[model samples]
Target: MNPFYFVFGRSANMVLILIFFFCPVSPSYGYDPLDPKGNITIKWDLLQSNSDTNDVKVSLLNFQLYRHIEQPGWKLGWEWLGKEVIWSIQGAEATEQGNCSRFKGGQLPHCCENKPLIVDLLPGAPYNIQTSNCCKGGVLSSMIQDPTKYAAVFQMNIRAGGAADSDFDMPQNFSLGVPGYTCAKPVQVAPSKYSSDGGRRWTQALGTWNVTCIYSQYQASTSPKCCVSLSAFYNDSIVHCPKCSCSCQGLPGSKCVKFGETPSLLQQVKDPNQEPPSIVRCTQHMCPIRVHWHVKQSYKEYWRVKITVNNLNILKNYSGWNLVALHPNLKSLTQVFSFNYHPLNQYGHINDSGMFWGVEYYNDMLLQEGEVGNVQSEMLLHKDEGIFSFREGWVFPRRILFNGDECVMPPPDDYPRLPKNTARAASFTLSIIFSPLFMLLIIFAC
Candidate 1:
């Protein structure tokens, strides 16, 4: 019954309660700082079934706001709980069919592998085999860009080992087949409803399972894929992208050709079937994509800016490429030439971000390492005098994102600054040396 012990016990209890209330919750493994709520959801719904087989519809929904699945699209794989085989598949097909020699006298199953890898069918698949939202070559657009194209669905006839419902098993070890994506085991979810006859009728699945997958960029690539450069009409010095923004030369996979050696390197014999490696023109910043932002001109009330996205890699062409810029002046955008623009007002009352992409069928496809390897666009924004100023790099973008991945920007101090008095002194000194050289050259020629 000591008073000190009683006070200590109360103090410890209060400390425990504070800790419980103030401790931060751990974020999920797939959490992204840019797209915090981004994740891919895979759903499997049992449609119909016979004694030995069940028809199930598998769907992939991209819930990410800006991230998307692009070229060489998504590949889905899963381990079968039972001796389940794909008797038939629609909207998609198995990459390979393993040996089914044990089955003697009937039609062969579509795939007999214990772990089957499935891929979406390409465009122009036969009508009989196509399902709704099934074939897009696995390309799923981001929800913010195009909501209608963000989901993919495929149905398959699963041949089970037993006849009863309990004997039927769920799939395990689901894989998205794309690196950096980790999928969790399937979990039972409420049945997904379907609409028929134009929303006049509705049907619910008998059973449904869902698998959630998150992406970590570090797991997907060793380095960033893009970088940003800055230039302004007022400053003579162009601030280039940071050195080794994506990667450095002499690294194992960083193979690049010298500026003049690109043609010879391209002519060299290479295996056609093998995937092409990243062969970019030698530069300090070894990034595949370089987005250049230039403050072109200033008018009485409107300022002009030019954005040019260059594809440095010799083999990769970006299809449906998009760029996002976060700048306060974007809200006052008056004109955008040669590219489509969409405002990304992520936070309410904040309209500082805008997405830009090439106009379709014109410059939509940013080609690789040639005359047409880049896409350029111009923007005119009405300046807000209260906050608009060319000093202290205020005209430059706050952030630039290429293809949803944030590009490494030059340091704030490295940004192109307005011409100072010292710049004119250096120019005069250069003129003095070049003037003597010009006279000497004329005398020698005469």
Candidate 2:
């Protein structure tokens, strides 16, 4: 019996060795099958403004899961495992303004109060799930703090055949929690007359101000009384008078009165000789008139006469004198003549007692080397003087004053010819010429 037992044992051992060698078991671990009837329970804390109140509604969108596989060197593989899960917590009721409610189909039902969704996973595969409300295109996604980290907690369960596998545990539960972005209702404060400052402050009367009489100084019998007097009158309308039998209103003999007449409007003045002033030619009599100097761009100097004249004179002599130095853009700079005597002298020179007028040139005078533009004293009289005069709506340059140097006169062809006046010949003359050197001095100083 011992020999037969030994033979049987040896045969059995040989058969086992053959099986091990021929089968060549792969280097792998086996996972027990999952229970088909098992359910995964998931719970998440509802997001709230201040505390863990389940009154706020929150939801997840674009939910997804990934599985980590060892065979492929622990690479991450995406799985649409969210479709397998069902929601458990619908959300809380909406009572406050902009709050979400469970009665509304779109509202999120409360957690634990609502059913949770189950996610399915592949057997033996390590998996993770994530959810995002970003695709919902609302304030929820942007307002959530650290949404990416919060989304990493969704879990998944797998059913492999019928048995449960210890290796097939559910992924950690996560959430893209609801964001507290509801705006609070704005409260408005109305303006109050009793505020600390003199101005009104906001009160229950909205933004409108309640007008109240703020007594000021009195001007006439109808003017409002002074604040002190008004205060006395407000307290007591009647008071005893010291001298007269008739009682003086509140605080006897007080200059202040309850009301007074309104101030009168200012009166407007008019002048009879207010004709539009006209431009007149600089006559020989007006030769020594006062001149004011100014500078211009491109190294040029300008001169003008300052005077005020009646508007009628300006209209009558519109074409006689050329208001040269005034800039076209600076109309205010134009000189006007007047009949009244001016206290200030022209360039510090006293003027003769008479109704004086001024004439100006239209263009700036250019300066050359060794040329002095300003004259300390008036120039000597000359024949055929190049004078600018206005007449019958026409401007005439009677003569061109030329010095020894190339006078740089305006091109003869460019000169406009008056219908009834002939172009005067250029003449040599001495006059107070404007110099461009002065312009350079002004430019450098500035």
Candidate 3:
């Protein structure tokens, strides 16, 4: 025997297997294998200018399939290549107006900062300041969910007095100021086209450039936000989410409070001003969100499943939240209750994926930690007798995603297993034992 195997024995192999399944793995940044072509592109279109200033229409297009900008939405910033100042802006505004003491005449520039941070206007912005697709408070949905809401646009006029021969250089050091994203330098592309009067007339930009950005979960520098638990009807075993599935207690941004441990902590959680994704009820898994999957019932032709989502973080409410499950049985789904269901057939002809969310004005907004901190739904799927089996964790979902982030699932060994003396096993043995007698009786009757 090899010395390594002789010394470690079979127990050592089990330890290695657990490590392979539970331990965190380092992931590469800037590319996602699942969504390889997904990216957010910033398009800057310089419109035809007859005056001294340059008019530009900047649009942020979300080309990603599932990722979206959530509340307290995106902040876009860039450094000017030249001494360019914003003369006027519509649909968006600069966060700060820097010192403009050098210029002493005429209408003052809207902003004099060399590197101004821009943010989208709210829905109720004045009519004079509004433009098409201008104000959504920087919230851009995923292209796959809603293509019409996947882009944000604004128009600005730049006064570059120091430019030579009316030439404008591309800006440098572009940033979304949101974590997990890094942008590439702007590349000149063919001019973008525009349609006016309901597509009757066409217009084109004088010049166009694009900046592409990609997201990396590791670069976000945050722990996972969600986890999963599982249960079944035939077994008493309930598999809770793994301990410390997201982060360990007492770590930064993992603060929690036990019942009556800190009375003030509850008050702090109730405070509207507190920061989010922390200040949760204490639990073994320090995740903000928990998704529970329960095999509710089994019938001759159909199986029922119940899904519940819990919000542990008291400081935040999830708006437009959604849950996705990958299971072989989802293709035969017959009915769903309470929540809205949609098939996400990202891969053609493979229908093993489905997405679920809450109904409008009812449970759409998952409330903070309280009596109403969760949303649940029931699903009925037609059982496929050809391959359907409850053994070896076949009934549970293969993967679960909450708000586009995959949740951590329990190990396969931890799933509920059928008892040796269960009703099904006993029936199988009885049938085998009586088969000969039953066959003889059938021959006599024939």
Best of the candidates, TM-score: 3
Q: Candidate 2, after superposition: displacement of residue 362 in Å?
A: 80
CA shift at 308, candidate 1, in angstroms?
A: 0.3
Instruction: Compute the lDDT for candidate 2.
Output: 0.21
TM-score of each: 0.84, 0.13, 0.85
Which regions of candidate 2 are displaced past 4 Å? 18-446
Candidate 2: worst 10 consecutive residues by lDDT? 225-234
For 39-149, candidate 3 gives per-residue lDDT tens digits of: 889999999564467899999999876677766678889999778889899989998989887778888888889889999998899999988997888888776556798
Greater-TM-score candidate between 1 and 3: 3
Give the least accurate 10-residue stretch of model 1, judged by summed lDDT.
Answer: 24-33
Give residue 271's error in model 3 in angstroms: 11
Q: What overall lDDT goes with each candidate model?
A: 0.86, 0.21, 0.84
- Error of model 3, residue 276, in angstroms: 3.1
- Give the range of the ten consecutive residues with the poorest summed lDDT in model 3: 268-277
Q: Candidate 1 on 1-446: residue-level lDDT in tens? A: 99999999999999999988897444326575456678899999988867788889999999987777877789899999778889899999998999777667889989999999999999999999999998898889888767899999999998864444534578899998877789988899999999978899899998999999988766777688899999998878889999999989998878887776755556777643233677888889999899999999999999999999999998877877888899989989999998988888767678888888777689878999878899998999999979988999889999998877779999999998877679889999999989999999999999
